[model samples]
Target: MNDHCNRCVGCTVQECRHHSDCEDFCTLDRVQIGTHEGNVTMDQCTDCKSFDRR
Candidate 1:
């Protein structure tokens, strides 16, 4: 994992390639957030666009 992963916040996607195994933090300093365009209305509507398949 990169050293920057230590500063990650609220990361839960353990399957992502950028996610650290030990600390469970994301390596990216910034993560792209987005949502489907149909009927989004809550925080659950958002998704981490930065996710990459591990």
Candidate 2:
């Protein structure tokens, strides 16, 4: 992920895909194979278009 998005405090990338409502563009469910707690795979964030390094 980029520094901008990563530095954004309280910015959960999951919210971008609206995982609470939809799962179509959500990469979380695909990579996350363990507990639904902290088992989220961050690779999804790197591929996110919203991730701005600037």
Candidate 3:
């Protein structure tokens, strides 16, 4: 959790290093989105490539 907040990016993932503890947003200006499945199917298959474990 952090004190910084990037209003454009709404995030609820507390495990991420970019996630803000005071607000439901990210601290990064930009985020990378990716998929883990061989064939993109559902939303669960998607992932935040910019995520860094806290």
TM-scores for the candidates: 0.73, 0.16, 0.86
| Clash count list over all predictions | 0, 0, 0
Residue pairs that clash (backbone atoms under 3 angstroms), model 2: none
lDDT of 1 by residue, 1-54 (tens): 544564646686889887877676888778888897578888888888999999
List the candidate 3 regions with Cα displacement exceeding 4 Å.
Answer: none
Model 1 scores a C-alpha lDDT of: 0.78
Error of 3 at 19 (Å): 0.3
Q: Give the TM-score of candidate 1.
A: 0.73
Kindly state the number of residue pairs that clash in model 1: 0
Model 2: residue 7 alpha-carbon error in angstroms = 29
lDDT of 1 at 32: 88
Q: Rate the local accuracy (lDDT) of all candidates.
A: 0.78, 0.35, 0.90
What's model 3's TM-score?
0.86
- Worst 10-residue lDDT window for candidate 3 reads 1-10
Candidates 2 and 3 compared by TM-score, better number: 3
Residue pairs in candidate 1 whose N, alpha carbon or C atoms collide under 3 angstroms: none
lDDT of 2 by residue, 1-54 (tens): 322222222334454542323322332323322333355566543444443232
User: Once superposed on the true structure, which residue ranges of model 2 sit more than 4 Å away at CA?
Assistant: 1-13, 17-20, 26-47, 51-54
